[model samples]
Target: MPKAIYAIWWDPNLGPFLGRSYPENDPLTSEEAVVIFMGHGLQQEAKVGYTKLAKGLVVSYLDSPNCIAVLLDENDDPSVVERNLLRLVGRINFNSSKWDAEITRAFLLLQELIAETSGQELLSNPHVTRLVEDMATGRVSALVPRHVLRATAKYPKASDYLGPDEEEVSRLLKDLERAGHLVPKTYGRRVECRQCGGTEVTLELACPSCGSNDIYKVYLVFCPKCGNRTQTVLVDDLTEVRCQQCKQPAKVSELSVIDVELLCKGCGQATNDPKIVLSCANCGKHMTNTDLLGGTGLAYYPA
Candidate 1:
Protein backbone atom coordinates (compact mmCIF):
# COMPACT_ATOMS: atom_id res chain seq x y z
CA MET A 1 0.00 0.00 0.00
CA PRO A 2 2.99 2.32 0.37
CA LYS A 3 3.04 4.68 -2.60
CA ALA A 4 6.80 4.28 -3.02
CA ILE A 5 9.51 1.66 -2.55
CA TYR A 6 13.31 1.78 -3.06
CA ALA A 7 16.30 -0.57 -2.67
CA ILE A 8 20.03 -0.26 -3.33
CA TRP A 9 22.94 -2.71 -3.80
CA TRP A 10 26.15 -0.73 -3.54
CA ASP A 11 29.38 -1.59 -5.15
CA PRO A 12 31.76 -2.22 -2.25
CA ASN A 13 31.71 1.62 -2.29
CA LEU A 14 29.16 3.79 -4.11
CA GLY A 15 25.96 2.15 -2.84
CA PRO A 16 25.34 5.05 -0.47
CA PHE A 17 25.09 7.41 -3.43
CA LEU A 18 21.60 6.09 -4.28
CA GLY A 19 20.00 7.64 -1.19
CA ARG A 20 20.77 11.19 0.05
CA SER A 21 23.46 12.56 -2.26
CA TYR A 22 26.56 14.66 -1.67
CA PRO A 23 26.58 17.35 -4.37
CA GLU A 24 25.61 18.10 -8.02
CA ASN A 25 25.70 15.24 -10.63
CA ASP A 26 28.55 13.10 -9.29
CA PRO A 27 28.86 9.23 -9.22
CA LEU A 28 31.28 6.36 -8.45
CA THR A 29 32.91 4.05 -11.04
CA SER A 30 32.32 0.41 -12.10
CA GLU A 31 35.33 -0.95 -10.19
CA GLU A 32 34.48 0.64 -6.85
CA ALA A 33 30.72 0.72 -7.37
CA VAL A 34 30.27 -2.96 -8.19
CA VAL A 35 28.04 -5.01 -5.84
CA ILE A 36 25.69 -7.97 -6.12
CA PHE A 37 21.97 -7.39 -5.39
CA MET A 38 19.07 -9.23 -3.80
CA GLY A 39 15.29 -8.62 -4.24
CA HIS A 40 12.06 -7.46 -2.56
CA GLY A 41 8.44 -7.96 -3.63
CA LEU A 42 5.77 -5.60 -5.05
CA GLN A 43 2.49 -6.28 -6.91
CA GLN A 44 3.65 -4.78 -10.28
CA GLU A 45 2.59 -2.25 -12.95
CA ALA A 46 -0.14 -0.47 -10.99
CA LYS A 47 2.65 1.97 -10.19
CA VAL A 48 5.30 4.40 -11.49
CA GLY A 49 9.07 3.79 -11.54
CA TYR A 50 12.56 4.64 -12.87
CA THR A 51 16.15 3.56 -12.14
CA LYS A 52 19.16 5.62 -11.00
CA LEU A 53 21.07 2.91 -12.89
CA ALA A 54 20.06 3.31 -16.53
CA LYS A 55 21.26 1.68 -19.76
CA GLY A 56 24.53 1.79 -21.82
CA LEU A 57 27.00 0.99 -19.05
CA VAL A 58 24.06 -0.33 -17.12
CA VAL A 59 22.13 -1.69 -20.09
CA SER A 60 20.96 -4.68 -18.12
CA TYR A 61 19.72 -2.73 -15.10
CA LEU A 62 16.07 -2.82 -16.15
CA ASP A 63 15.28 -6.44 -15.14
CA SER A 64 13.80 -4.97 -11.96
CA PRO A 65 13.04 -1.74 -10.10
CA ASN A 66 15.32 0.65 -8.14
CA CYS A 67 12.26 2.59 -7.02
CA ILE A 68 8.55 2.27 -7.78
CA ALA A 69 5.20 3.89 -6.93
CA VAL A 70 2.34 1.38 -6.63
CA LEU A 71 -1.33 1.86 -5.81
CA LEU A 72 -3.20 -0.34 -3.37
CA ASP A 73 -6.19 -1.41 -5.42
CA GLU A 74 -9.19 -2.99 -3.68
CA ASN A 75 -8.69 -6.36 -5.42
CA ASP A 76 -4.88 -6.29 -5.02
CA ASP A 77 -4.25 -7.72 -8.47
CA PRO A 78 -0.47 -7.66 -9.00
CA SER A 79 -0.60 -10.41 -11.62
CA VAL A 80 0.41 -8.29 -14.63
CA VAL A 81 1.84 -5.40 -12.62
CA GLU A 82 5.30 -7.00 -12.56
CA ARG A 83 5.53 -7.51 -16.32
CA ASN A 84 4.21 -4.01 -16.97
CA LEU A 85 6.94 -2.65 -14.69
CA LEU A 86 9.72 -4.40 -16.69
CA ARG A 87 8.72 -2.69 -19.99
CA LEU A 88 10.72 0.35 -18.84
CA VAL A 89 13.81 -1.84 -18.72
CA GLY A 90 15.52 -1.75 -22.08
CA ARG A 91 16.66 -4.60 -24.21
CA ILE A 92 20.43 -4.04 -24.45
CA ASN A 93 22.63 -5.10 -27.37
CA PHE A 94 26.02 -4.43 -25.81
CA ASN A 95 27.52 -2.92 -22.61
CA SER A 96 28.97 0.62 -21.97
CA SER A 97 30.17 1.19 -18.36
CA LYS A 98 33.90 0.38 -18.77
CA TRP A 99 35.58 3.77 -18.99
CA ASP A 100 38.97 5.32 -18.06
CA ALA A 101 40.27 8.01 -15.61
CA GLU A 102 39.03 10.73 -17.99
CA ILE A 103 35.59 10.05 -16.55
CA THR A 104 34.36 12.94 -14.36
CA ARG A 105 32.12 13.61 -11.36
CA ALA A 106 29.33 14.33 -13.83
CA PHE A 107 28.08 10.70 -13.94
CA LEU A 108 27.85 10.64 -10.17
CA LEU A 109 25.54 13.61 -10.22
CA LEU A 110 23.33 12.06 -12.92
CA GLN A 111 22.67 8.97 -10.79
CA GLU A 112 21.63 11.09 -7.83
CA LEU A 113 19.23 13.01 -10.05
CA ILE A 114 17.27 10.16 -11.74
CA ALA A 115 16.91 8.37 -8.41
CA GLU A 116 14.42 11.14 -7.72
CA THR A 117 12.65 11.89 -11.03
CA SER A 118 10.18 10.52 -13.61
CA GLY A 119 10.93 7.80 -16.23
CA GLN A 120 9.91 9.66 -19.42
CA GLU A 121 12.21 12.67 -18.97
CA LEU A 122 15.18 10.55 -17.98
CA LEU A 123 15.04 8.64 -21.29
CA SER A 124 14.42 11.68 -23.52
CA ASN A 125 17.13 14.28 -22.74
CA PRO A 126 20.55 14.47 -24.47
CA HIS A 127 23.08 16.61 -22.56
CA VAL A 128 22.13 15.26 -19.13
CA THR A 129 24.77 12.54 -19.59
CA ARG A 130 27.75 14.41 -21.10
CA LEU A 131 30.59 13.69 -18.62
CA VAL A 132 28.91 10.62 -17.15
CA GLU A 133 30.89 7.36 -16.97
CA ASP A 134 28.14 4.74 -16.63
CA MET A 135 24.53 4.69 -17.83
CA ALA A 136 24.08 2.12 -15.03
CA THR A 137 23.62 5.11 -12.73
CA GLY A 138 23.31 8.87 -13.40
CA ARG A 139 21.16 12.00 -13.89
CA VAL A 140 17.88 10.63 -15.19
CA SER A 141 16.52 13.82 -13.64
CA ALA A 142 18.23 15.84 -16.38
CA LEU A 143 15.31 15.02 -18.62
CA VAL A 144 12.99 16.00 -15.80
CA PRO A 145 12.10 19.62 -16.69
CA ARG A 146 12.35 20.95 -13.14
CA HIS A 147 15.77 19.32 -12.51
CA VAL A 148 17.28 20.41 -15.85
CA LEU A 149 19.14 23.59 -14.79
CA ARG A 150 20.38 22.22 -11.43
CA ALA A 151 22.77 19.61 -12.94
CA THR A 152 22.65 16.55 -10.68
CA ALA A 153 26.36 15.95 -9.86
CA LYS A 154 28.40 12.72 -9.76
CA TYR A 155 30.53 11.04 -7.04
CA PRO A 156 33.90 9.28 -7.15
CA LYS A 157 34.45 5.53 -7.52
CA ALA A 158 36.04 5.75 -4.09
CA SER A 159 32.63 6.07 -2.38
CA ASP A 160 30.72 2.90 -1.46
CA TYR A 161 27.98 4.44 -3.65
CA LEU A 162 29.39 2.29 -6.46
CA GLY A 163 28.03 -1.11 -7.62
CA PRO A 164 29.90 -4.09 -9.06
CA ASP A 165 27.39 -5.79 -11.34
CA GLU A 166 24.67 -3.52 -12.67
CA GLU A 167 22.27 -6.45 -12.26
CA GLU A 168 22.86 -6.44 -8.51
CA VAL A 169 21.91 -2.80 -8.35
CA SER A 170 18.80 -3.64 -10.38
CA ARG A 171 17.74 -6.34 -7.92
CA LEU A 172 18.28 -4.11 -4.90
CA LEU A 173 16.17 -1.33 -6.34
CA LYS A 174 13.36 -3.71 -7.31
CA ASP A 175 13.46 -5.27 -3.86
CA LEU A 176 12.93 -1.90 -2.21
CA GLU A 177 10.21 -0.88 -4.64
CA ARG A 178 8.46 -4.17 -3.97
CA ALA A 179 8.78 -3.76 -0.21
CA GLY A 180 7.41 -0.18 -0.30
CA HIS A 181 10.60 1.29 1.22
CA LEU A 182 11.16 4.11 -1.29
CA VAL A 183 9.08 7.22 -1.83
CA PRO A 184 8.30 8.04 -5.47
CA LYS A 185 6.36 10.98 -6.83
CA THR A 186 2.78 10.61 -8.04
CA TYR A 187 2.44 8.63 -11.29
CA GLY A 188 1.90 10.74 -14.43
CA ARG A 189 -0.15 10.25 -17.62
CA ARG A 190 2.41 7.84 -19.13
CA VAL A 191 1.86 5.24 -16.38
CA GLU A 192 -1.86 4.82 -17.10
CA CYS A 193 -1.50 3.83 -20.75
CA ARG A 194 -2.14 0.20 -21.72
CA GLN A 195 0.36 0.49 -24.56
CA CYS A 196 3.57 2.41 -25.28
CA GLY A 197 5.47 2.61 -28.57
CA GLY A 198 5.39 -0.85 -30.22
CA THR A 199 4.77 -2.63 -26.91
CA GLU A 200 1.06 -3.47 -27.27
CA VAL A 201 -0.65 -6.40 -25.55
CA THR A 202 1.88 -8.90 -24.22
CA LEU A 203 0.24 -11.50 -26.48
CA GLU A 204 1.25 -11.31 -30.10
CA LEU A 205 -1.72 -13.02 -31.78
CA ALA A 206 -5.21 -12.67 -30.30
CA CYS A 207 -8.11 -15.01 -30.82
CA PRO A 208 -10.02 -14.02 -33.96
CA SER A 209 -13.34 -15.22 -32.52
CA CYS A 210 -13.41 -14.12 -28.87
CA GLY A 211 -10.30 -11.87 -28.76
CA SER A 212 -8.76 -13.94 -25.96
CA ASN A 213 -4.99 -13.64 -26.25
CA ASP A 214 -3.97 -15.43 -23.08
CA ILE A 215 -1.87 -18.65 -22.86
CA TYR A 216 -1.87 -19.46 -26.57
CA LYS A 217 -3.29 -18.22 -29.84
CA VAL A 218 -4.96 -21.49 -30.81
CA TYR A 219 -6.63 -24.70 -29.70
CA LEU A 220 -7.59 -28.14 -31.10
CA VAL A 221 -10.55 -30.42 -30.57
CA PHE A 222 -12.01 -33.66 -31.98
CA CYS A 223 -13.96 -33.55 -35.23
CA PRO A 224 -17.48 -34.95 -34.81
CA LYS A 225 -17.80 -36.97 -38.06
CA CYS A 226 -14.39 -37.66 -39.64
CA GLY A 227 -12.35 -36.90 -36.52
CA ASN A 228 -9.71 -35.87 -39.04
CA ARG A 229 -8.88 -32.38 -37.80
CA THR A 230 -5.72 -31.87 -39.81
CA GLN A 231 -3.91 -28.68 -40.86
CA THR A 232 -5.17 -28.88 -44.41
CA VAL A 233 -6.77 -25.74 -45.82
CA LEU A 234 -10.09 -26.86 -47.32
CA VAL A 235 -11.63 -24.76 -50.05
CA ASP A 236 -15.39 -24.68 -49.93
CA ASP A 237 -17.94 -22.31 -51.55
CA LEU A 238 -15.54 -19.54 -50.52
CA THR A 239 -17.86 -18.89 -47.60
CA GLU A 240 -18.44 -21.90 -45.38
CA VAL A 241 -15.81 -22.71 -42.72
CA ARG A 242 -15.30 -26.24 -41.45
CA CYS A 243 -13.84 -27.43 -38.18
CA GLN A 244 -10.98 -29.79 -39.02
CA GLN A 245 -11.73 -31.52 -35.70
CA CYS A 246 -15.46 -32.26 -35.73
CA LYS A 247 -15.23 -32.31 -39.53
CA GLN A 248 -18.49 -30.41 -39.23
CA PRO A 249 -18.56 -27.65 -41.83
CA ALA A 250 -20.67 -24.57 -41.11
CA LYS A 251 -21.99 -22.18 -43.74
CA VAL A 252 -20.61 -18.63 -43.54
CA SER A 253 -24.26 -17.68 -44.08
CA GLU A 254 -25.26 -19.34 -40.82
CA LEU A 255 -22.82 -17.41 -38.64
CA SER A 256 -23.77 -13.90 -37.60
CA VAL A 257 -21.15 -11.23 -36.87
CA ILE A 258 -24.05 -9.02 -35.85
CA ASP A 259 -24.01 -5.90 -33.66
CA VAL A 260 -20.30 -5.45 -34.19
CA GLU A 261 -18.44 -3.01 -36.41
CA LEU A 262 -14.90 -3.46 -37.67
CA LEU A 263 -12.28 -0.79 -37.15
CA CYS A 264 -9.98 -1.17 -40.12
CA LYS A 265 -6.39 -1.40 -38.83
CA GLY A 266 -5.57 0.38 -42.07
CA CYS A 267 -8.14 3.20 -42.16
CA GLY A 268 -8.58 3.44 -38.37
CA GLN A 269 -12.33 3.97 -38.51
CA ALA A 270 -15.75 2.28 -38.36
CA THR A 271 -17.12 3.45 -41.72
CA ASN A 272 -16.94 0.09 -43.60
CA ASP A 273 -19.19 -1.86 -41.26
CA PRO A 274 -22.10 -2.52 -43.63
CA LYS A 275 -24.58 0.11 -42.57
CA ILE A 276 -28.38 -0.24 -42.42
CA VAL A 277 -30.21 2.95 -43.37
CA LEU A 278 -33.99 3.50 -43.47
CA SER A 279 -36.32 6.12 -45.00
CA CYS A 280 -39.90 6.14 -43.76
CA ALA A 281 -42.38 5.65 -46.65
CA ASN A 282 -44.49 8.24 -44.82
CA CYS A 283 -42.35 10.26 -42.28
CA GLY A 284 -38.87 9.63 -43.74
CA LYS A 285 -37.29 8.35 -40.48
CA HIS A 286 -33.94 6.98 -41.72
CA MET A 287 -31.82 5.00 -39.23
CA THR A 288 -28.59 3.00 -38.97
CA ASN A 289 -26.93 0.41 -36.68
CA THR A 290 -29.26 -0.02 -33.72
CA ASP A 291 -32.13 1.73 -35.49
CA LEU A 292 -32.15 -0.84 -38.31
CA LEU A 293 -32.02 -3.84 -35.93
CA GLY A 294 -35.04 -2.72 -33.88
CA GLY A 295 -37.59 -2.10 -36.67
CA THR A 296 -40.78 -4.19 -36.37
CA GLY A 297 -41.20 -4.50 -40.17
CA LEU A 298 -39.53 -3.51 -43.43
CA ALA A 299 -40.93 0.04 -44.03
CA TYR A 300 -42.60 -1.24 -47.27
CA TYR A 301 -45.08 -4.05 -46.53
CA PRO A 302 -47.64 -3.40 -49.24
CA ALA A 303 -51.20 -4.29 -48.19
Candidate 2:
Protein backbone atom coordinates (compact mmCIF):
# COMPACT_ATOMS: atom_id res chain seq x y z
CA MET A 1 0.00 0.00 0.00
CA PRO A 2 1.10 3.55 -0.73
CA LYS A 3 0.87 6.52 1.60
CA ALA A 4 -1.57 8.89 -0.03
CA ILE A 5 -0.43 12.53 0.08
CA TYR A 6 -3.67 13.92 -1.26
CA ALA A 7 -7.16 12.66 -2.30
CA ILE A 8 -9.94 14.24 -4.34
CA TRP A 9 -13.55 13.47 -5.19
CA TRP A 10 -15.09 15.39 -8.07
CA ASP A 11 -18.52 15.54 -9.71
CA PRO A 12 -17.53 15.94 -13.32
CA ASN A 13 -20.90 17.42 -14.23
CA LEU A 14 -20.91 20.12 -11.54
CA GLY A 15 -17.21 21.08 -11.46
CA PRO A 16 -17.29 21.24 -7.64
CA PHE A 17 -14.75 19.14 -5.69
CA LEU A 18 -13.88 17.74 -2.27
CA GLY A 19 -10.25 17.05 -1.42
CA ARG A 20 -7.73 16.96 1.38
CA SER A 21 -3.97 17.16 1.76
CA TYR A 22 -2.60 14.78 4.35
CA PRO A 23 0.16 15.29 7.03
CA GLU A 24 0.63 18.98 6.16
CA ASN A 25 -1.86 21.64 5.27
CA ASP A 26 -1.50 23.10 1.78
CA PRO A 27 -2.28 26.82 1.29
CA LEU A 28 -4.47 26.24 -1.80
CA THR A 29 -8.25 26.56 -1.56
CA SER A 30 -9.74 23.24 -0.37
CA GLU A 31 -10.18 21.81 -3.92
CA GLU A 32 -8.35 24.23 -6.28
CA ALA A 33 -5.60 21.78 -7.23
CA VAL A 34 -7.95 18.78 -7.15
CA VAL A 35 -10.36 20.22 -9.71
CA ILE A 36 -7.46 21.29 -11.97
CA PHE A 37 -5.95 17.77 -12.03
CA MET A 38 -9.38 16.16 -12.40
CA GLY A 39 -10.01 18.35 -15.47
CA HIS A 40 -6.61 17.44 -16.81
CA GLY A 41 -7.49 13.77 -16.41
CA LEU A 42 -10.83 14.23 -18.23
CA GLN A 43 -9.02 15.74 -21.24
CA GLN A 44 -7.53 12.28 -21.82
CA GLU A 45 -11.11 10.92 -22.39
CA ALA A 46 -10.37 7.52 -20.88
CA LYS A 47 -12.84 6.33 -18.26
CA VAL A 48 -10.08 5.07 -15.97
CA GLY A 49 -6.42 5.40 -16.84
CA TYR A 50 -3.48 6.89 -14.94
CA THR A 51 -0.74 9.16 -16.17
CA LYS A 52 2.71 10.10 -14.88
CA LEU A 53 3.06 12.92 -12.41
CA ALA A 54 6.38 14.84 -12.19
CA LYS A 55 9.47 12.82 -11.29
CA GLY A 56 8.75 10.26 -8.53
CA LEU A 57 5.15 11.48 -8.07
CA VAL A 58 2.24 9.07 -8.74
CA VAL A 59 -1.51 9.52 -9.16
CA SER A 60 -4.46 7.07 -9.44
CA TYR A 61 -7.66 7.55 -11.44
CA LEU A 62 -11.12 6.10 -10.90
CA ASP A 63 -14.39 6.96 -12.66
CA SER A 64 -17.85 6.34 -11.32
CA PRO A 65 -21.34 7.45 -12.32
CA ASN A 66 -20.93 11.14 -13.20
CA CYS A 67 -18.05 11.33 -10.70
CA ILE A 68 -14.29 10.90 -10.69
CA ALA A 69 -11.69 10.24 -7.99
CA VAL A 70 -7.99 10.96 -8.09
CA LEU A 71 -5.38 10.04 -5.52
CA LEU A 72 -1.89 11.45 -5.21
CA ASP A 73 0.68 9.27 -3.50
CA GLU A 74 4.44 9.16 -3.19
CA ASN A 75 4.67 5.60 -4.53
CA ASP A 76 5.54 5.18 -8.22
CA ASP A 77 4.71 1.51 -8.84
CA PRO A 78 1.83 1.77 -11.29
CA SER A 79 0.64 -1.77 -10.53
CA VAL A 80 0.29 -1.17 -6.80
CA VAL A 81 -1.45 2.18 -7.28
CA GLU A 82 -3.79 0.67 -9.87
CA ARG A 83 -4.63 -2.25 -7.58
CA ASN A 84 -5.66 0.12 -4.80
CA LEU A 85 -7.59 2.24 -7.30
CA LEU A 86 -9.48 -0.81 -8.58
CA ARG A 87 -10.30 -1.91 -5.07
CA LEU A 88 -11.76 1.51 -4.41
CA VAL A 89 -13.77 1.22 -7.57
CA GLY A 90 -15.21 -2.06 -6.34
CA ARG A 91 -16.44 -0.42 -3.16
CA ILE A 92 -18.04 2.52 -4.99
CA ASN A 93 -19.77 0.20 -7.44
CA PHE A 94 -21.09 -2.03 -4.69
CA ASN A 95 -22.69 0.89 -2.90
CA SER A 96 -24.51 1.93 -6.10
CA SER A 97 -24.93 5.59 -7.12
CA LYS A 98 -22.00 7.80 -6.10
CA TRP A 99 -23.92 11.08 -5.78
CA ASP A 100 -25.51 12.35 -2.56
CA ALA A 101 -24.56 10.96 0.88
CA GLU A 102 -22.86 7.97 -0.72
CA ILE A 103 -19.97 10.24 -1.76
CA THR A 104 -18.80 10.53 1.82
CA ARG A 105 -19.12 6.79 2.33
CA ALA A 106 -17.16 6.14 -0.84
CA PHE A 107 -14.22 8.33 0.15
CA LEU A 108 -14.15 6.82 3.64
CA LEU A 109 -13.93 3.37 2.04
CA LEU A 110 -11.03 4.50 -0.12
CA GLN A 111 -9.16 5.97 2.83
CA GLU A 112 -9.78 2.83 4.87
CA LEU A 113 -8.50 0.53 2.16
CA ILE A 114 -5.34 2.59 1.76
CA ALA A 115 -4.78 3.23 5.47
CA GLU A 116 -6.29 0.33 7.45
CA THR A 117 -4.29 -2.81 8.27
CA SER A 118 -7.14 -5.24 7.55
CA GLY A 119 -7.34 -3.94 4.02
CA GLN A 120 -3.92 -5.46 3.33
CA GLU A 121 -5.05 -8.82 4.81
CA LEU A 122 -8.19 -8.83 2.66
CA LEU A 123 -6.05 -8.75 -0.47
CA SER A 124 -4.60 -12.13 0.59
CA ASN A 125 -7.90 -13.98 0.03
CA PRO A 126 -7.82 -15.52 -3.42
CA HIS A 127 -11.37 -14.55 -4.30
CA VAL A 128 -10.96 -10.93 -3.25
CA THR A 129 -7.58 -10.80 -4.93
CA ARG A 130 -8.99 -12.11 -8.19
CA LEU A 131 -11.99 -9.80 -8.07
CA VAL A 132 -9.81 -6.74 -7.55
CA GLU A 133 -7.45 -7.83 -10.33
CA ASP A 134 -10.37 -8.54 -12.63
CA MET A 135 -11.75 -5.07 -12.03
CA ALA A 136 -8.37 -3.52 -12.72
CA THR A 137 -7.85 -5.53 -15.87
CA GLY A 138 -11.30 -4.60 -17.24
CA ARG A 139 -12.15 -8.28 -17.41
CA VAL A 140 -15.36 -7.65 -15.48
CA SER A 141 -17.87 -4.85 -15.46
CA ALA A 142 -17.57 -2.11 -12.84
CA LEU A 143 -21.09 -2.61 -11.56
CA VAL A 144 -21.32 -6.23 -10.50
CA PRO A 145 -24.74 -7.67 -11.16
CA ARG A 146 -25.56 -10.66 -8.97
CA HIS A 147 -25.38 -13.43 -11.61
CA VAL A 148 -22.03 -12.35 -13.04
CA LEU A 149 -20.02 -14.12 -10.35
CA ARG A 150 -21.31 -17.55 -11.28
CA ALA A 151 -20.97 -16.81 -14.95
CA THR A 152 -17.43 -15.63 -14.38
CA ALA A 153 -16.59 -18.83 -12.57
CA LYS A 154 -17.48 -20.79 -15.68
CA TYR A 155 -14.93 -18.87 -17.63
CA PRO A 156 -11.62 -20.59 -18.37
CA LYS A 157 -8.94 -20.23 -15.66
CA ALA A 158 -11.44 -18.73 -13.25
CA SER A 159 -11.96 -21.85 -11.18
CA ASP A 160 -8.23 -22.43 -10.81
CA TYR A 161 -7.71 -18.91 -9.51
CA LEU A 162 -10.90 -18.88 -7.43
CA GLY A 163 -11.02 -22.29 -5.82
CA PRO A 164 -9.42 -25.70 -5.67
CA ASP A 165 -12.63 -27.27 -6.97
CA GLU A 166 -16.15 -26.33 -7.99
CA GLU A 167 -17.53 -27.60 -4.68
CA GLU A 168 -15.25 -25.31 -2.74
CA VAL A 169 -16.29 -22.47 -4.96
CA SER A 170 -19.88 -23.18 -4.07
CA ARG A 171 -18.93 -23.25 -0.38
CA LEU A 172 -17.19 -19.89 -0.67
CA LEU A 173 -20.29 -18.47 -2.29
CA LYS A 174 -22.40 -19.76 0.58
CA ASP A 175 -20.11 -18.02 2.99
CA LEU A 176 -20.45 -14.80 1.02
CA GLU A 177 -24.22 -15.25 1.12
CA ARG A 178 -24.07 -15.54 4.91
CA ALA A 179 -22.07 -12.34 5.09
CA GLY A 180 -24.77 -10.46 3.11
CA HIS A 181 -22.38 -9.76 0.23
CA LEU A 182 -24.56 -11.75 -2.17
CA VAL A 183 -28.09 -11.27 -3.40
CA PRO A 184 -29.79 -14.65 -3.43
CA LYS A 185 -32.29 -16.08 -5.88
CA THR A 186 -34.18 -19.34 -5.99
CA TYR A 187 -33.43 -22.04 -8.55
CA GLY A 188 -34.69 -25.52 -9.22
CA ARG A 189 -32.78 -28.12 -7.26
CA ARG A 190 -29.98 -29.46 -9.42
CA VAL A 191 -27.90 -32.50 -8.62
CA GLU A 192 -24.37 -33.18 -9.75
CA CYS A 193 -22.72 -36.57 -10.18
CA ARG A 194 -21.13 -37.57 -6.89
CA GLN A 195 -18.44 -39.55 -8.66
CA CYS A 196 -17.46 -37.15 -11.42
CA GLY A 197 -19.08 -33.85 -10.37
CA GLY A 198 -20.88 -33.79 -13.67
CA THR A 199 -24.13 -31.79 -13.79
CA GLU A 200 -25.94 -34.19 -16.11
CA VAL A 201 -27.91 -35.88 -13.34
CA THR A 202 -31.61 -36.54 -13.89
CA LEU A 203 -34.01 -36.30 -11.02
CA GLU A 204 -36.74 -38.92 -10.73
CA LEU A 205 -39.39 -39.80 -8.22
CA ALA A 206 -38.80 -43.35 -7.03
CA CYS A 207 -40.42 -45.68 -4.54
CA PRO A 208 -39.03 -45.27 -1.03
CA SER A 209 -39.21 -48.99 -0.26
CA CYS A 210 -38.55 -50.75 -3.58
CA GLY A 211 -36.63 -47.98 -5.40
CA SER A 212 -38.86 -48.22 -8.48
CA ASN A 213 -39.29 -45.24 -10.79
CA ASP A 214 -42.59 -46.47 -12.22
CA ILE A 215 -44.96 -44.70 -9.87
CA TYR A 216 -47.91 -42.38 -10.33
CA LYS A 217 -49.56 -39.90 -8.00
CA VAL A 218 -52.56 -41.44 -6.17
CA TYR A 219 -54.58 -40.95 -3.01
CA LEU A 220 -54.11 -43.39 -0.17
CA VAL A 221 -57.32 -44.58 1.53
CA PHE A 222 -57.45 -46.37 4.84
CA CYS A 223 -59.62 -49.36 5.70
CA PRO A 224 -61.39 -49.66 9.09
CA LYS A 225 -62.35 -53.33 9.11
CA CYS A 226 -59.05 -54.74 7.76
CA GLY A 227 -56.83 -52.05 9.30
CA ASN A 228 -55.08 -51.70 5.95
CA ARG A 229 -53.98 -48.58 4.12
CA THR A 230 -53.60 -48.71 0.32
CA GLN A 231 -53.96 -46.83 -2.95
CA THR A 232 -57.52 -46.00 -4.00
CA VAL A 233 -59.05 -47.40 -7.19
CA LEU A 234 -61.54 -45.14 -8.94
CA VAL A 235 -64.97 -46.72 -9.28
CA ASP A 236 -68.62 -45.72 -9.98
CA ASP A 237 -67.76 -43.19 -12.66
CA LEU A 238 -64.99 -41.79 -10.40
CA THR A 239 -67.55 -40.91 -7.75
CA GLU A 240 -66.22 -43.51 -5.28
CA VAL A 241 -62.86 -45.04 -4.44
CA ARG A 242 -62.13 -48.58 -3.26
CA CYS A 243 -59.19 -50.01 -1.29
CA GLN A 244 -56.59 -51.74 -3.53
CA GLN A 245 -55.77 -54.31 -0.87
CA CYS A 246 -59.17 -55.31 0.55
CA LYS A 247 -61.32 -54.33 -2.48
CA GLN A 248 -63.74 -52.62 -0.05
CA PRO A 249 -65.21 -49.14 -0.03
CA ALA A 250 -62.52 -46.71 1.12
CA LYS A 251 -64.50 -43.62 1.96
CA VAL A 252 -62.89 -40.24 1.22
CA SER A 253 -62.49 -38.63 4.65
CA GLU A 254 -59.72 -37.02 6.65
CA LEU A 255 -59.58 -40.14 8.86
CA SER A 256 -59.68 -42.57 5.90
CA VAL A 257 -56.78 -40.98 4.06
CA ILE A 258 -53.99 -42.42 6.16
CA ASP A 259 -51.00 -41.39 4.04
CA VAL A 260 -50.68 -40.33 0.43
CA GLU A 261 -47.60 -42.07 -0.87
CA LEU A 262 -45.93 -43.66 -3.87
CA LEU A 263 -46.80 -47.25 -4.78
CA CYS A 264 -44.04 -49.24 -6.43
CA LYS A 265 -45.46 -50.85 -9.54
CA GLY A 266 -42.77 -53.55 -9.41
CA CYS A 267 -43.20 -54.68 -5.79
CA GLY A 268 -46.82 -53.56 -5.04
CA GLN A 269 -45.63 -52.14 -1.70
CA ALA A 270 -47.20 -48.85 -0.58
CA THR A 271 -44.94 -46.27 1.04
CA ASN A 272 -46.06 -42.94 2.46
CA ASP A 273 -42.90 -41.32 1.19
CA PRO A 274 -40.95 -41.46 -2.04
CA LYS A 275 -37.29 -40.90 -2.72
CA ILE A 276 -36.38 -37.89 -4.80
CA VAL A 277 -33.44 -39.61 -6.39
CA LEU A 278 -30.81 -38.43 -8.84
CA SER A 279 -29.35 -40.62 -11.53
CA CYS A 280 -26.02 -39.45 -12.84
CA ALA A 281 -25.88 -39.60 -16.63
CA ASN A 282 -22.13 -40.03 -16.63
CA CYS A 283 -21.27 -42.18 -13.65
CA GLY A 284 -24.39 -44.38 -13.50
CA LYS A 285 -24.66 -43.93 -9.76
CA HIS A 286 -27.94 -43.20 -7.98
CA MET A 287 -27.65 -40.25 -5.60
CA THR A 288 -30.02 -39.36 -2.83
CA ASN A 289 -30.65 -35.78 -1.69
CA THR A 290 -27.92 -35.95 0.94
CA ASP A 291 -25.34 -36.95 -1.65
CA LEU A 292 -26.10 -33.97 -3.90
CA LEU A 293 -24.58 -30.49 -3.79
CA GLY A 294 -27.04 -27.63 -3.68
CA GLY A 295 -26.28 -24.33 -5.38
CA THR A 296 -28.11 -21.03 -5.15
CA GLY A 297 -28.65 -18.67 -8.01
CA LEU A 298 -27.12 -15.43 -6.76
CA ALA A 299 -25.46 -12.17 -7.62
CA TYR A 300 -22.31 -11.13 -5.75
CA TYR A 301 -20.57 -7.82 -5.12
CA PRO A 302 -18.03 -6.71 -2.59
CA ALA A 303 -19.49 -5.37 0.60
After superposition on all CA atoms, what RMSD does each candidate show versus the true structure? 22.9, 18.1
How far residue 88's Cα lies from its native spot in candidate 2, in Å, is: 1.2
Give the per-residue lDDT digits (tens) of candidate 2, residues 1-303. Answer: 343333444555764455433332332343454443554344433334443433234444534323333445454345444444555655554344434445455556656654431335545676757855664566653332222312222322335456555544543444444434443455434454445444555668888877788875566666765777776643244545666677776445433665566667888876766787667654557866644646433434444
10 residues in a row with least lDDT, candidate 1: 143-152
The C-alpha stretches of model 1 lying farther than 4 A from their native spots are 1-42, 46-107, 111-203, 208-303
TM-score of 2: 0.30
Each prediction's TM-score versus the true structure: 0.19, 0.30
Candidate 1 residue-wise lDDT, 64-160, digit = tens: 3332212222333242233333432232111325222112222232233334223333323332222122322442221111111111111222112
TM-score leader:
2
Stretches of model 2 off by over 4 angstroms after superposition: 5-16, 19-44, 51-58, 62-73, 92-155, 163-303
